[model samples]
Target: MTYAPMAVMQPTAHNRAAETPLPPHAQITYMERTSSELPVTEFFRIERPSFDPATGQARFFYRLNDLSFTETLQLPMGADAAMAVSPAFAKLLGLTGLVLGVSYFKLRAPFAIEAPEIALTDAERAFVIDVYENGLGEFYARNDLARFGKLSLVAPTDPVARQPALDLPDRTLLPIGGGKDSLVSVDLLTHTGVDFTPFAVNPKGPILTSVAAIGTAPLYVTRTLDPDMIRLGKEPGYYNGHVPSTAINSMIAALCALLYGYSQIVLSNERSASEGNVVFDGRETNHQYSKSLGFELLIADTLANATGGALKYFSLLRPYSEARIASLFTQSTKFDAVFSSCNRNFRLTGNDGPLWCGECPKCHFVFLIFAPFMKKERLLAIFGKNLLDEPKNEHSFRELAGLTGQKPWECVGEILEAAACFYTLTRHADWHEDAVVRAVKADLFAQYGEEKLQLAMAECLTDSRDHHIPPALAAKVAAYAV
Candidate 1:
């Protein structure tokens, strides 16, 4: 692949050679460009060693250079495992460069960082700068900080927080997803008397149906993936793995918020988003780092600064856990039939396939968590099968129960929630005869025992209360026995 050359160099070298080396398997090369131009930066190359089958070890390196900085990431991999990153992820990195350019303009910083010879159009640069400044302004105000420390250069003074008794208009932007989270959010916001406008992108059948069931004013955005980009994947050499969905979704959410003219953009993101990613070296990195409080705050700050305090962005369900959100939906019969947490149906290319690929981690975790609260038959109807009945799902259930492996990095709450439900179900006489439940009891349940399980449940509940579960939901949960 072709790449632009470096623009200029102001080298300030600092060494930390004592730091522990990263694993051999994964490497990431990050290049930031504040240049006012399209295609301002490029990721030139990535290299990974062939794994040794006998010894089970591999190494990888990533390199990138722009006028300002040349950096490399080195990683080692085990024979049985590999580190994967998608080309979509590289696009996000590109977008991040654009965002940084916007940020630099807003901050009016002395240094102009750009890819060598690449320049942005004046209009595009202004738009990015405006958005970043608007976002940062609100962030400082909301946090009650006296001044923008490092962020001051990019953000204007926040006027919104200066007003002591500001009346925020009761306008809501409905976050649409092909999952249960949005369904629950729609229900809660509707019942709470907020005037809402439903917004969706890349429409699909199940999501459209769910939105219709909510009976709200719906707005749809059409999105078409660039055909040339898709064609690139068909070539003999293409990189694909996982792009941080949070980054893409945040951009989409911001765009939607702008078009809809809504003050508050309500997202259905849950507490589990704060859970760290499982690193290749058995260490944990926050997988939802993009979805976590840090990203949310940064985006919100950037919008406030860029817009001059005109917009507000936040996850309304940020304080709620997946389990608590599930419980909230369970209480509302209106959503019982409409909601779905299955990931299979949400994919862009897999509609003709099974709606619930029951073997996936998400399906197994969701089914297990909801089992104790919803009636057996009713829950099965929602998922189209008794997921706990299958031996394959049973294995997944054990994995989630913290039996065979570390918790899956997607969401921390899944493991804790499943553990609580498994604890509750094993003690109940009615659920005792279920094959998966029995298997759970024999294989993993017996090891934890009742006291340990109950303690684990209490810890989960306490942790949820401390971080994830919203106050209103916490009150409701306090009244309900697990």
Candidate 2:
């Protein structure tokens, strides 16, 4: 199903104030909740967002009732003169402001989102609606917002002219997560001789160190969140949980592509990211929804249309599963010491955290998935512990292998993909006796027979027909992933 992103949200006379520095707005004061315990937020509004071609600074404003919030980013780039003159920049900025609204909108989560300031086409309206509804699926499920009313987006606008496809530089900008998956892409792209630059919005220890091992200069951007937003999360009556972070990052990448003259925004999201974690109120929510193939296609098409194919977006590792990616990751040793997939280590505002926090689902899953593919000593040394041998981690493995409970609310593979790894471990002499392996063996086999497990393992090792990889890069992906 191709979603047509027609000339969207044509800006009107409102452009002058939007392009200029923001005028003073009301402060998003605390305690908007009424005495009845129900929030009084009836609507969420996207105020005009601004960008300065001189400094590459951008600001986004949003409001919930009388309260207003701001978010800003200082990009390490000068805005493109040509792109600034074109309609692409404004449209991209507007769309970006619309998507970034999720961060603040999730705070109050009112039923209505009104963008009367910017006029949007029907297609733009649909895109924004999806950004709020499906993009916030995990937030809704986690907060158990079933009793809350359905969400609506109102973007009354006249259609504007679409930008013709501009000729962007022939280069790839890869977002490094300081994980095994992105490192695999770095190795594969390097070996295949692709001209790409490692990019990150905010560099953390792991991401910086891992990129340093690649021995190349990486482009880094600085994004600053409103301190009030963080402070409010600690305040009473405020809602906080996961948001569609990848969606926000994707928009940022597109902006960088425009300003920095990069043509391709390469991601390393695997095939298994498409799976959702749970179903609530007849709605399925995926922790990795923004990283999934569906979101990939949507954003890819949106960029292709918005930038007129001047900028392209696709996950280079989309055809492979987490287990397969792990197998490929073991083939590279350059980032073994510095790479970390632990969620705790990738916090937005922290440093010097442990490379691996052994207790989390990310740690357990990464260790377990890699156990079947790597040597015991090497894999264990990287994580600084043998997660499978620990008795307490058995329950984490249990949920990952689908023996009990729902799929974890983390960036993990499908249940069968995890079960395949566990079953392969059960057959391995090195890992068969591990506490987690032994504990899950009976229930794992009972739920998925030996033959089925073997089939799942084989399937994960094979390629998927579903992906948005360009034809030129297809063989490289197959060679590296398989």
Candidate 3:
């Protein structure tokens, strides 16, 4: 029934605003409760941060139920021409602050099923569904698939004041994740002469190396989760799992677009992300749910509502398949040495020793995707070793090729797409002799027959029209599509 004061992490020159009290953490407990007994008094708030130009830092705070969290973002000194920022942009940042809280809120899910959706409008509620239900669909299905179907969310009934539109510039804000798809996006934007600034959260070795490969500086934004969430995850009652990271990152990009006066926010998600890994309780659980077209539309519509249709957010590579993205990435050998899709290498602090661990699903899939596009020697040189050439990779490729087992719970292309890539390579002189490829090809041909392999290859070459790419950018993106 009480409130926890927002914790400020950094000292800044900007003055603090009055703190509005909200529900405390003790108000919600998980012990011995049925679905109907779930607490409804839970509240989440995004407190306005004070930005100190002297330190070039902005300190923001948020609360979920009773747990308080603080995140600080330090801007580069003298990056912009003006020191003054508009209030509308501050509100946009607050919206992003709310998103920051929601991402961490997943650590408390199922236990605290009810959120302050009453704080959101009808459109905002729909956006929240995409962010929570769909975005966290993988998290729920992984932890408790059965109970997930019974969960329902409530929306805010209170009216919100709409703000006037901002006079945004033509520049685009592109978010980079130190991968082939983002690097390909950078190439497309540069080729079209579109003004853009590469944006990232918690810049590390792989991200820095990838951005440096293209010869440009990036606008780095940092997000720090409360250490208590990690501690709480170890507790008996608190739930923990993956959150819709791309959804969270998109919100960060949206705020950056507003703060830097950019009208467009560009992402690098591919069309293959739309497919689900498995269906459970009448819902599809996709690891890349946040990157799907549905989430993209929700984000676009939500941003329009929040910012008066002045800001735009969508993926530049949404039309291209993973195979097509791999082909386009092969166009520029400049990034081959630095680009990595291995999720293992990416961390909050630093990349693991090797860029390619060559063990995980991502490493195996990246190897398969690049096999048909780049030469065997060049691909091996980039990965430090040929993944498909390794005899130990047969099982991994089996999952990728769908010759055996379910698709691994990783951000990979669908089973048929992987099969298509592997099948296509069997006909190519460069890859047919590799050990893993030979094993996968032999197994797939034996199980599904040669005709199915042929069909899989044909499907890989086709592009999906299910995207929200703007009319102006569609021509430019299509030029690079395979």
Question: Among these predicted structures, which one has the highest TM-score?
Answer: 2
Clashes of 1: 40
Runs of candidate 3 exceeding 4 Å displacement: 1-66, 75-91, 110-119, 145-163, 480-482
- Please say which candidate is ahead in lDDT: 1 or 2: 2
Q: Is candidate 1 or candidate 3 better by TM-score?
A: 3
For each candidate, what is the lDDT?
0.48, 0.78, 0.69
Write down the TM-score of every candidate. 0.62, 0.90, 0.84
| Candidate 3 lDDT by residue in tens digits, 1-482 | 11232221010111111131111321212233345544656444556555665655767675667878777776555533341255455555555655555555665554333433225566665565556676777676666533443445443453654556767888888888888889989988888778788888887777889888767767887766677766777788667777788888887777666656778898898877776665544555678888877778878877876677788888888777788788888887888778788887675456557888889999999888888889888998988887878899898888776665556778887566687788788889988898987776667777657876676556556665667778878887677454
1 against 2, candidate with superior TM-score: 2
Give the lDDT of residue 141 in candidate 2: 67
lDDT of 3 at 90: 55
Backbone clashes in model 3, listed as residue pairs: 25-66, 117-155, 117-156, 118-156
Give the clash count for model 3. 4
Sorted on lDDT, highest at the top, how do the candidates line up? 2, 3, 1
- At residue 325, what lDDT does model 2 achieve? 86
For this target, which candidate reaches the highest lDDT against the unseen true structure?
Answer: 2
